[model samples]
Target: MHVTDACGRGGATPPSRWDPAEPDPVAGLLATARRRLGMDLCWFSRLIGGAQVIEACDGDAAAFGVHPGSTVHHPGPHRSHALAERPLPVVGRIRPEAVTSGTATEATGTAATGVEATGGPLAGRPEVGSYIGVPVTLADGRPYGMLCCLSRDADVAMPARKTRSLALLAEVLSASISDRRSGGEYREAAWWRIWRLIDSGGPTMVFQPVFDLPSLDCVGAEALARFPPGSGGAERWFADAAAVGLGPALELSAIRSALRAFTCLPPEFGLGVNASPATILSGRLADAIADIPADRLVVEVTEGDRVEDYPSVRCALGVLRREGVRIAVDDVGAGYASLHHLVQLQPDFIKMDQCLTRRIDADPARRALAAALVHFAQETGSLVLAEGVETARELGVLIGTGVHQAQGHYLAPPGPLPLPASANRTRPPDTA
Candidate 1:
């Protein structure tokens, strides 16, 4: 929360913000409701494959002209301002207004977290469920949004208990976001609720200074998202996100948070962000990058967990490429299967993972791996990036291998990055 509330004694509610929604009624009610609905997207648009859906979205999805949902997205008049006009940042949940119907039938065991939208570019988009969002706030309220579950099913109306529960959640959500007492407020807190811990003016960002190997000049910046509050460290906060099924949500929030900080960066530098394959598959990536200048951004696909669907991941990456976002295969040599993904993706940049970069001057095996990755990148006309260059000797070896870029503590540790006074004026040596 960005607001400054005067006279403390704010209050407490036992983290029990609100009760969760109850299940919806049985199948008969759902079927009847779904049948009553008129003209859905599939019915309105001509039958085309996912490609056609993509074509429609690319052509005109925003106008709601491209495709209609199985049910109307805005059933009646636009009622968003009601929930949206608050100060809390809506994180894990959807907007209250977007609530359509809740299910009492059975839990599909799927999460409410945003997912890869399906079909075209619009497919696998984050937030597929019916929902609405609005921000709530305390005094110095930094307005946030709410993600409320409108309806459990696309066609059904949510039960009264569910709506009431969601509404209760909305209220607590507002308070949780607005309650920014001190650094220790987030320990053991719900991960999504951790948004309240967002530092002043929202979350802060540090741009890892990236040096072009041959030129040894600052050519780009990798945006590293870090929260200032320590109620829980980065690992804890990140862990919470995964627990609440909001890994992608947090990642997207971090990217947007990074972008807000990016405005201060020197315009010439390309901005890079660590992106996960999970997010790419969910599909709102294009929507996320739609506002950013494609020429100035590089989305490094850092694989965590595992690459479940390479084809889908590749397809999403291809779209990003088509849109001009540079792709980088991060941690190239750390994973045994990395090379295969690298070869398949044919990324614009291949970052030598820190495992291989650390102590490379003394390790023959690491050096060999580095050499092989560099050779592959060069052969494919892709630039090589060497991260974790913590020593002069290590840097020397990287320069010798003809690696294209380097970043690490020796050059710069991840800090509130704007090229500190020591770094802003300094330049990398011209190894070429």
Candidate 2:
């Protein structure tokens, strides 16, 4: 029996913040209600998989032999009212007179803490006599569970106002649960879609040619991924895959698809594939590129995010390098993490971020940075490749800045290999 909040996902509550030690919003509400109503305990129990499990609680749970995750038996009638689909009257055994004078229903013979045959407020703990519970319902009018408060004393007066407040609290909990469940469902759907895509051999691969600025000759092509139409951009698809823990598999699939182009591309032209630190560290990337000619393969390590462990990534790349594959640090000058990566990875190529090249002809700041990166690359025995060059002016600026190579819409939009003649400046005449 998994104890979750009013929502169906497996957790006592949605995290209140980054810190797990902090009390969650559901727990805070339970505490406030418990103190205001003067109850010995207040807890939210979610009916998950047909078991009544405590998800969040406030007050001395141990005293009543219950805690979060404790599965308890509920009287059939009371439970029906608590989880009713409509706004029925609140159910309780608040006072001696209000107590349902009957032998408490027998408990289901399930293995659970604090569960017993006596269906009292605290189930096994017969000492709890004052109990008030309101149904928590989802937006779809389905019963989620109950918001309940109880006390050890039978004659405790649960005022009308307090009962109303409890109902309101339940309503708030219901809304939160509904919203969370909806988000969870959306993510699950997205995950399944990406999973199926990967299962079907990953996103379509397209190669955008990267050219040497001076010669304007086809040097290599960067492999870009293309998901199905209306599936959003390539970045979004990869993000969705990453969120669902399938990032590495999807990326490797893309790499494998890109490798297929090696059979079509001229031996002189190299192929650049994008990879994150995570995929590189997976230890499969080296194997993926092993069949291709080593010198004609470049792995562009994307710097959209920071790498957690540089030493491990360096070691991983080293393996690929030893086998003749080159490494390029991508999106340089776009962020501090990229700069940090440049220092740590010491890659064979430094690909300038598009932002720095977008309008370098007009922005002196951009030119200065581009020049500085080129100089840095020169000093470090690395080549600087300007990415995303979209105009003649930007291309001229990058060329004048001594960028070794460049790629973007200006160079060529990604398409099938064997570069389009319009984009191909000078292919080796001898190469077939």
Candidate 3:
């Protein structure tokens, strides 16, 4: 059966109505919830024709016939159906007799419903011993579906805090669904394309040289994520991923892909990877670069999301620093926060943003600001790197300002491979 859109307009399509073979973001959320919550199974179902139809599921739910595209009839008073009718979360233990005998009669007494129950699919399942669920609702307060988990252990219990956590997960699912519908066909199509790109490992890794300005020698190469030839620019692709709540996942994937090129890079050059503060705090970054020599890796924190807990972030970075991993703050001089981050983190390197680097030769104010940053970095013992040197004049001004390192189209563009060692010292003309 086709799922109706939240708008109740016949033309709007629901997530459930999409092709079953397509990847459902809700499925990923359900799987994550199940693993995080240590539940036997988790599934998302929508109410259709007085029954619950499983649209996405994870774990062992499929063993009991709770698979995607499967329909389970839950008459008027079944606990699962009753939970879906409300807008709040519900959690309760299933009686042992319900699973032992595959009967609803004994379990009905413990159910959170005020109405009597007729036998339903959930009642016949001899595996589910407890249930916790949150109603998925639309922006207009209408119920869209339910995100629920079931466990086979009768003694299983969920804390009050866990209920709230489940509610938040449900809200994320609701928002993702709403985005798909509200974004119209173009956005929905774009989401699918990006989803495929990520799933197929569509991004290719390229390295651009970062040069030490005074010595005119390449000291490092920043790993940049490049999509397929016709897949559009990197910025647009990343923006779309962020819009769909897949930003961190994609960034992590890119980092992992970039690391594969470590062996190909020259031993003297540090491998730089761009990551947001959120990704840095996740601790997964540590694992991604763990095998490589820590001193050869530079974690350049990109200015994407704001850091909420500076102390926690500092502690995480400290652990990596102890292992010889260095940190670099990207896009400095672009905003006040970047300067604040410089002081708080005391990174090993500070990268000047392109906004300040572009046309630095013509702008005295920018030159002064760059010089000041250079002096600050000098005093703090942090090396300053000027980014986006597109012209000879910009490079000359950056060099005059005592910027230790610089990189841009003027030096080299990202390529499938790093420039050979012989070409590292001489400044290459703008290739683009």
Candidate 4:
């Protein structure tokens, strides 16, 4: 056996080690175990390719001749615990003869019978007088590492209760490590998926036409994104991208893809594209629509999280508004955030959420709310666009409530670009 202290001799650096300055769950648990066991040193050693690698430690590491990132070749408390088919007895007051070349105490009445010292707990560590440790296993029941406590005084007690406490702590630490590893692996996978999507030129764009409620003329189309097969729903894909810190990148990619609509849209009709508040503040949206005539674009702002700095948002939007790009406050009736956005943005359009428009003809409350929003939009110089007008009754109710525009499956579902011809109307529906 060979004992190598990496901190002093520059051996292989341990892949993972505890840093006292950082707040890590395993580090906290190791310190708690050492204090509870009343030991001078407590450490976790991961068995990597038959070598015990000191991954974490608490208390006096220098005195024990072992520090985090050190490696002990073989034959130590950790190795024995990991290999044992059953739990081994906690060795307290280890006899000198069993651990080192030192002579036995006169009181023990035994001669020196030192074991072959290779690279283990006792190699150049004759002062390690008491030892207690337990194997840490993964979810699959395979031994992953060992949590060990050591004391310099030979008379240090290893009570049954203390041994039990150490074992319980090892179990808790094992679960935490497993959970952290799982989360890390998931994030890694999500990162790669998003990378591939962006590299492939983003999501496919589909057009959902927004029609004038009375004339039924095709005024514009809202571009919606359709992700690759098996990538899950569009909303979830964007959400996962956000979780991996690629929210703005993914949104920008989608915007770029949706801009492809210009080739198919009629010259007279405009295009609407969705963007989150974060993306708007990034200062990239203006660049995306720079080449396209600004008057032909409508940026409908969608938000899952509230914006903390409204002044910054307004400043960013103000820059675009001056350049001919119109803004729409999306999902206005879904939550208070949309209402807040309307107050702050004073957008060109207010899109009532589908929930408020789904069955307004049958629900008097929804109808009343729609009327109130129309009045509000009128006061603010904003046009009310009621989304999800699936029936003639819904369309009639929306027009009667003074909604200027509408879109839903009833008019035409989202499909490949090339806007459908405007639906003809002999006369405007009677609002009376």
Candidate 5:
């Protein structure tokens, strides 16, 4: 293969392998692998139009011709071709003499007479002293791409266990690609549906009351997105939008739709909106709610989105906080990272995960955890909100544990558009 540097000298523009608008979803995975494995460089390559193109990469390997948009022609001898044909993991030290002399190594299986004998593109790169790669294959056994790591030291050696771990990561990337590629027609139709929804002024918003535990009176309402008839659940629609690289646009549209309810809500009721950390950091949320009073808006950071940089997130949150926008760490107890978020961000609200509050009245263990979080919120001077309180017993338990606020069907189901004037006056069901 004719491996050429994308960032070549003389100011020549390199061809791009990915859609410029869409965020590289697997970029974080490659970065994590490089960091954990202590490799000089890490990258992912996909065979496109008969050539292997670098799609994503991280670390100093960029200096060694590893970069997005770089291409390696699938001709003659090359390690990438071998991996594509056999779909096996490759790891070994690169002999400088062998590479410069145009000799193919046993590990790469490149032809000795073709590109190797003529000093092909990959040859004469002294920086690449050692290399390791795992085939990223599709679910049906087709070679989709390759995950590779390289080092500058000739004697570098990776343990078999590490190589296996690398393979597992490749499997994950493969699965993600498979999911994006599968259901082609369905996804295309869904994409159009979502695009039309956003272009036509976005989805409708339903307000669900959040009640103060002691007073049993509405203190706020979380804006829930509801699509037009037959558009599917809000979650699925958003996921589909993200897979198609329209996540930020769709989310911004939804936020704008949700914010319109601020005028309809009572002055005493705060408005909570769900958003991913990426959306928050994008500064779009700040601009969307610029006209609205920040105290009235609670930006609940959604859980499970991998956060690579905590400092950047914290900085973003700080900017919003200064503008009176309150932050809420959503889905607490759903994952270990949630706890870390609570500690790091020190948000104004802590919304316990539904799984932990599902049956807290009957589960002592759940109650204890909820109680502890409530106490933590108290110490942090933040309000504790228990989500998905479906039973009077659960509501009673939440109140007893000093949870400041809550929202679920048991308190008040999400109300339709043009919410009734009494929506903010919703009271808890009579437990007596």
Candidate 6:
């Protein structure tokens, strides 16, 4: 996808794949994200749609890591109305924190005058007096983008306009984030805002239905986190934590939240929690590891974030695994490292990324990856859990592949905990 530079200028040339005038494909991709979270919802907003990558903050955004041909989209007073329909207004890119804080509904100006984000684009535009916008989030708790409204010479936030309308619009904004993952780009900003809430501990947990192939019954859960509006948001929670090198702290806190949230859950239910390599590889994780009840943990390792050394990470993982902690190489096939890691660390679990899991029924390549992952996990004595299962056909393929468990919307959205258990239930003890 495209990322805007700090100056709001796209530079000498625009992105090859992106036409700022037509971000629908990107928007459509974003709309497809289905967040079934227990805490505040995890956004896949277009930010999640195509999603944003934190550049190293070197050179232009493209050098940082923006996708090919993608340039940032600007929403000015002239372009403000466009947001009414599209919602997520991509700006020239900035720091991840700026993305989060900017997307939240912090009014730019007080009602002293009738304006939304005062001194904003609309302010300079003729007859513009008000503005409004919401941030989007990604599945991993990053800002996606935003949707907003503006009223020329009118108070957009005026209390007299049947405040409930604003309430309805807020609800609409909320729903849009959930809906956008499937096809809307506008929700990207909202998704980010949601993350900021989670980062702040506003988001809680939900356990979703995960199935076991042998039993053909529900077994474990994907530990999903959610955030509510007015919360600190995932950005502040995770990004700031990252900036200060406290990812492990946030992760530990999230695990505690899950423990409290899932305490009543049956022993058979396992919760999948997101983790970063930095958190995993950090020497300090011993204490964090000690805090997690060994029985309840199903750590999913997402590679999208930083991980300096693989061998050391594997050793750290070994330490946890030795303690009866079940380990998972999450999002395999979604990035570059899993295979090397799979060979080096040989985790107790392998969560095939949804990109590979999505069309397995129709695509042979996906099926092969599923099969290979299953074989690798089996050889390593690790369980295979395919994440983001969205289709019955995909489920059937997973079963055919001999995966130990499955998670995704095909069964149900990630939501509140304590799903019922049966003989086929996920074996928490088995994880160790």
Candidate 5 per-residue lDDT, tens place, 205-323, comes to 88888887778777778888888776579888888877654676677778888898887777877888888877777766777888998888898988746788999999988888989
Model 5 ranges with Cα > 4 A deviation: 1-190, 417-432
Q: Best by TM-score, which number?
A: 2
> Mind giving the per-residue lDDT tens digits that candidate 3 earns over 1-432?
232222231222222324445567886899888887778888888866555677878888645556677654433344445455554455666675654454322232233322112234454555566677777887666677778777776544456666778888988888878766565555566656765665565478888888877767777789999888876888988887665545665687788888888788788888898887777787777777778888888988877767778998899898889889999999998887787788889999999999999888889999999999989988989999888888877887888889998888877777877564422335554433
After superposition, candidate 6 runs with Cα above 4 Å error: 1-202, 230-244, 289-292, 422-432
In order, candidate lDDTs are 0.55, 0.74, 0.73, 0.75, 0.73, 0.51
State which candidate, 4 or 6, has the greater TM-score: 4
TM-score of 3: 0.58
lDDT tens digits, residue span 169-220, model 4 = 9899889877766766676677667766776777888999989878888988
Which run of 10 residues does model 2 get worst, by summed lDDT?
106-115
Question: Each prediction's TM-score against the native?
Answer: 0.53, 0.83, 0.58, 0.80, 0.59, 0.49
Measured by TM-score, how close is model 5 to the native structure?
A: 0.59
RMSD of 6: 19.9
lDDT of 1 by residue, 190-279 (tens): 633654543223345677889877556877678876766655566666666654445665666677777664567677788888777777
Best by lDDT: 4
lDDT of 2 by residue, 1-432 (tens): 233212122322222212344335797889988988888889898866445688888898876656777775554554554455443434344323223342232212111012222234344444656566676889988877878776776533446776788989888888887777776676667766776676677789888988887777778889999988987998898887676556777788898888999889877888899998888998988777767887789999987557888999999999999999999989998888888989999999999999998888899999999999989988999999999877777877888989999888766888886875345433222211
Runs of candidate 3 with Cα error greater than 4 angstroms are 1-180, 184-192, 422-432
Candidate 6, which ten residues in sequence have the lowest lDDT sum? 33-42
Model 3: weakest 10-residue lDDT segment is 5-14
- Would you give me the overall lDDT of model 4? 0.75
